[model samples]
Target chain A: MTQPVLEVENLATHFFTRDGVVKAVDGVSFKVGAGEVLGIVGESGSGKSVTGFSIMGLIDPPGRVVSGSIRLAGEEIVARDDEAMRKVRGKHLAMIFQDPMMTLNPVLRIDTQMIEAVLAHDKVSEQAARERCIEALSMVGIPSPAERLVAYPHQFSGGMRQRVAIATALLHRPKLIIADEPTTALDVTIQSQILAEVQKLCAETGTAMVWITHDLSVVAGLADRIAVMYAGRIVEEGNVSQVLDVPRHPYTRGLIGSVPSANPLGARLKQIPGSTPSLGRLPKGCSFEPRCASASEACRAAKPDATDYPDGSRVACFNPYSLARAS
Target chain B: MLAFIIRRFAQALFVVVAMVVIVFFGTNVVGDPVWMMVPGDATQEQVEEVRRAFGFDQPVYVQFFRFLADIAQGDFGRSYVHGGSAIRLILDRMPATLELAVVALIFAVIIGLPLGLFAGLKPDHPASRAIMAGSILGFSLPTFWVGLMLIMFFAVMLGWLPATGRGPVTTFLGIETSLHTLKGWQHIALPALNLALLKISLVIRLARSGTREASLQDYVKFARAKGLSPRRIVGVHILKNIMIPIVTVLGLEFGSLVAFSVVTETIFAWPGMGKLLLESIQRLDRPLVVAYVMVVVLLFVTINLIVDILYSALDPRVRLAGKSE
Candidate 1:
């Protein structure tokens, strides 16, 4: 079998603060195959965004990838210096940030930024790079690519800016694209449009993607697989349909149950009890034990190792919800 | 855009008029101009004659109108102490001051921008920390003291460069002029260095803060994620973002250079407008003082206007208002 496009093993990112070390991402591991869209769904501070940033080698001071091996197309990026890592970033891996406006330099024209992105990686002619930029913009559904190229980031609306950002990320046709809540800032209609475009682009180009967002509905509609993270660990992993339909981990079940459509409308929606455990002072044993309804005394004794199920799903819980047993 | 320019010009006109009025009446309030210039005893008729010649004997309103008329026609009256046209004295000395200011500004930008970019890019790096500490000290030290120190180190102690005077420009302007020759630039070296040392610290502080802020911006992070080299990130992406603020502070500093030159030029005895203005003020030359102040104010206003236009060009968000125009 061909190797996955990207693989992360035992990824542990920690932020050393004055009080204590905040385990932003602890012992999280996942992979994305070619043309696969993997969604990492979690609330803020759940380490989902940190995981994506870690993969992109973007963790700055105070927070660092303490121990992890990030393999991009079989090359070890975690061990490379900053200079070498930069060479790998846009050429093999790219990222779309949450704030579209933040992804663009306000002073620069859209064409200049996009064309520069292209020329940075390739020794292409200016005209060729420009044409490629226009193609990328148009591919992302931006109209009048030529005219819009002359416009600045402020000229475009919020949604349009996001599209332009996506266009810039795609300009290099990188092997992997890590999108961290790219659609979260847009309206629902625009969000859906961007989601569909991203999905279609990945499918057609065979680009492996790690979609980091708290929006489960978006994941269900777009991602091929899902990894639900809590307190810097992946509690559940499976195909999207299997995980969303029959969530095994209590936290995963609670998350899906809390969604409006997951439960009946007009009824008090089931909520995941308790907030995410604080990174600085996470509870011992299982991080999710205090919030899990089915957690037993054994669950509170120690964290459970990931147990693979017959349906190719994995759950990290001592007392996972089983449909057969529940019935 | 035209309307904005018109409005800004009208505001500038009001400021200039107000400045002229203050200078005109304030000089009269200082007592008899004749006595102040001639020193010792002077007859009442001599004082009255001096006052009348200056049109001070007329109504204050009429005197102000005459002053405004002279300014409109580019005639800044005559200097009683120097016996030269006040406008001519200003024009003659203006280039020398501007030359020093321009060179000092260039030095400030060249040295400060890179230091700022380095400090910002590596906030925790030892070099950056050292630069930050050094710049703080540089900024806090008085300009005159800095000038004296440069003279002591580079001139008196090392005996390398001349201590004073505006160095001959012809030799410096020549393409073949080398440091080995030490002909013209050697004389300017002390004054220029003195002026730049203080301003460099100011520019570095501003550029460092701006660059640091720009580095944290989302676009910078995005650029990094795209795998652009750190060189490109700092040079192209981060520097451009930081330029707007840096340029603003630099422009203001450039304007202040003219004002601060009063002290530095005096210490160095350089033939610049600051020195000329000081002489005029000491001798109670009202026309020269007014003309000098007016020229400086005009420069400050013009530099600020240029900086504003540059600001919009550097940051798209600023130019958004232009769309409405």
Candidate 2:
């Protein structure tokens, strides 16, 4: 089989503060094949966004990747210097920020910013770059791509701005696109449109994607596979139907159960019992022990190692679910 | 946008009229113009003659009306001490002051803007910190003291340049003389540097603060994430956002440069409007004094107007608001 498009092994990212070190992404391991949409679902501070940022080399000062191997298209990216990393970025890998305004500059016209992005990685003529910009914008469903390209960022609404940002990332047809909650800022209908467009474009280009979001419903509708993260670690990961329908880890089960659609109508939606453990003061055995309902004495004494299943699912739990055990 | 300009112009006209009213009555309340203009040994009849000639003997209201009428006709009356038309004297002195200010502004902006941007981009660097400290010290020192120090070093001690008197030429008409060429630059250099030093410090501080804020803006972070080089991020994205506030501070400081040049001109005895205005005030030349103040006020108003127009051009939000209104 061809090598996975992107692979992360034992990736650990930490934040150092006056208080202490926050283990944001303790040990996240995952892989995305070509044309695969892998969704990482977690609450705020679960390190979902940090994992994406780490892969993209966007983590700022005071927070850094402690130890990790991030291989993009079979090359180690974590060890590359800033210049090498930049070459990979926007060419082989690209990202869409959560806030659309952050992705677009208010002072510059769309054409100026988009064409510059195209010209940065390629030795293309201005006319060719302009044509590519229009095609990208139109591909994202923007009307009058030529005229709209001349307009500044503020002239567009929030959803339109996000579409433009996605268009910019798509200009190079990168191998991997890490979207850090890109749709969280948009309304539901717009979110659905953006997600559909993103999925269609990725499939057409055979691009791998890591979608970081807290919305399980979005993952259910869009992701081909799902990795459930809690307190900086992935508790369970598998093909979308296998994990979402029959979650092995208690934490994953609780998350799937908490979704409104999982509960009966007019009933109080089930909620995960406790908040995520603080990174600095995490439980010694398991980070999610305080919140998991099936915690046992052994689970309290030692962290569970990841156990692989025959169907390609992995779960880190002392007591995992089985069909016979459930009966 | 045109409507905004019209509104600003109307507001400026009101301010000019208010300034004229204050100058007219304030000069009258100070003392009798006749007594102040005529020689001390002049007889009462001659003093009365001077007062009648200026219409100072009329009621204060009538005198004010006549003053406004003369101003409207572009006649600023005659200078009692200089024995020339007040407007002509002021106009003659203006070019010298304006030249000094324009050159100093160019120097301050050229030096201060880059220094500020560099300091902000690399705040922890030793060179940036040293420049920040130096700008603070430069801003705190008085202009006259700075001028004196330059003269002592470049003129008195080294004897590399003349010590004083605008240039080697005694007559103002010989301003075009060889003395006013390269040597004249050496003569004016100290005063101009003194005037520019404080402004440089002001611009540096303002630009640094503006740049720091712009650097933190989301678009700057976005630019970084876009994989653009650091040079492009700092030069294109961050600098453009910072320029609005820096331009505002620079415009106001440039206007103040006109007024502040008075002290530098006095120290160096430069042939500028500030020096002329100081001489007129000492001699109680009321017409020249009023005319000088009006000129300064008009200059400040015009500069502020230009800044406002540029503000709209630089920021689309401002332009949109202007269009809406």
Candidate 3:
């Protein structure tokens, strides 16, 4: 395959707080090729969002990307200064936040917001930028894009607002777009509609996407590949169907098992034994060991590094579930 | 929007009525104006004659109704001490007080906003801490004492500025103002600064808190992610949001500055409405005092209305709310 649009390797984003260092996105690595959708599945505080922020170079003080190499289209992201990084952002990469209502500035008109997003990357005339904004808006399925552009964010429904956000992200046609649960705040119906629209946009535009979400079902329908995160690390990474049908990582298996549809009707829903461990003081061996049903003596002794399997799956475990045994 | 303003005006009228009632009764409680007008050795017959002539012998409610009717016709009665139409006496002084209040407000906002933004942006910096400490002094230091200290240092010790009075007056468009002259600004500077101290402190605190709160909002973070320059992010996005609250507080404060800048005006002998108010109260000039207070009430009502309008302009949500109403 050609070079991936985004490549993040051994990225360690840590927050230096008063109590201790929080390894929010410790040793996370992933790749996204053109038109590919990589869904990062994890619970809250699993560093899924932080990973996105790190890629965008939007991490504020008290939190720093302590160690990592993030490359966007063969350009090193971690090496750029703030000014240079800003030039890359919105031009080469963009972000779509979860809460659409809060993402757009309430006082600013949709056109104003989108026009600025365009002007930030391109030096085109305001009229030209605005036309691009209108085009982008209509591409996201918004009706009467020209009129909608003049309206403030409050005038739009939650779904429409997210569409506006997506339009803003697509304004520059950046190489990569990090969507951090963009549809999570909308109704389920709206969520699917947005999901379909986003999927189509990604395919038509050939823009790479890192769709960070907590819902397994969302990634199942949207992502070509899936990466399961625990604590702060991707414990399983593989083709979506391969990983879903036969999850090698115990955590991944547990997650798939816990889904209601995966279990027989009227049967007890399978659950992981315990909550995700805090990043500050994770277990010595595996971060998921305390809750892992197949945890072994070796799993308790040392942390497991990711190992590649023949079927193009990656599992980070000392004793991963065997596919033959499951079948 | 028109309905909103009309409703606010109605509320303002009610407030004015309440003020008139309270001010009349409250001044009456301070003692009869007729006695204050009379000499110390006046006989009962002489006092009675004077009281009847001034209509002071009438019942309190009757006096209130008469006063209300007089004000409705733009007749604010005569100042007992100044011996002129009370409204005229106050209106002549209005320009000075308005100028001082506006200049003081400008001083407060210009000096406070940037400092407050700095402190908010870099809260842990030593310079920010010093700015915060200076703001605390601005809040706690008595205005009169600050005025005195300013006089001592700038006027008495340095002889750089006039110690008292509004300097060379320029009449522009039938109104007397000291602003057109250079020496006039020097004279007004100390007094305006003294008046602005507390307000500067207030704006600093308000801006600081507002900035801190707004910087945490999701929209601000999103602005950064949009790759907008930091200057644009803070100046446009963050500043605009924080201004909503700051405008509100400063608008009301401007009214108070105009109405009750008594100590600064007195200390500096600035010859404004506040000084007029103080003298009216001291001499028990009921008509002058009442007129001054009513003017202040009008000023406050007008200011509050403007603030509400400005608030709607700044926030679209407020504009929509006004539309619905």
Best by TM-score: 3
The models' CA-based lDDT, in order, is: 0.85, 0.85, 0.90
* Residue B266 C-alpha lDDT in model 2: 88
Instruction: Compose the digit string of candidate 2's lDDT tens values, residues B86-156.
Output: 97898788877876787788878898999998888778789999999999899788778888999999999
- Candidate 2 residue pairs in clash (backbone atoms < 3 Å): none
Model 3, B257-320: lDDT tens digits are 9866889999999999899999888777888888988899889988998898788899999889
Score residue A49 of candidate 1 by CA lDDT: 94
Each model's fnat?
0.85, 0.43, 0.70
Provide the lDDT at B180 for model 3. Answer: 91
Tens-digit lDDT track of model 3 for A1-327: 799999999999999999899999989888899999999999899999999999999999899999989999888989789999999888889999999999998878888788888888889999999999999989999999999899999999999999998998898888999999998899999999999999999999999999999999999999999999988999999999998998888888888889999889999998988898888998789999898788889988888999988877788999888988666
Q: Mind giving the per-residue lDDT tens digits that candidate 1 earns over A161-181? A: 999988888887889999999
Taking chain A of candidate 1, what TM-score results? 0.97
Cα error, residue B298 of model 1, in Å, equals 1.9
Per-candidate interface C-alpha RMSD?
Answer: 1.3, 1.5, 0.8
Number of clashing pairs per prediction, in order: 1, 0, 0
The reply for model 3, stretches above 4 Å from the true place, is B1-10, B25-69, B173-175
Measured against the true structure, the TM-scores of the candidates, in listed sequence, are: 0.93, 0.92, 0.95
DockQ of 1: 0.72
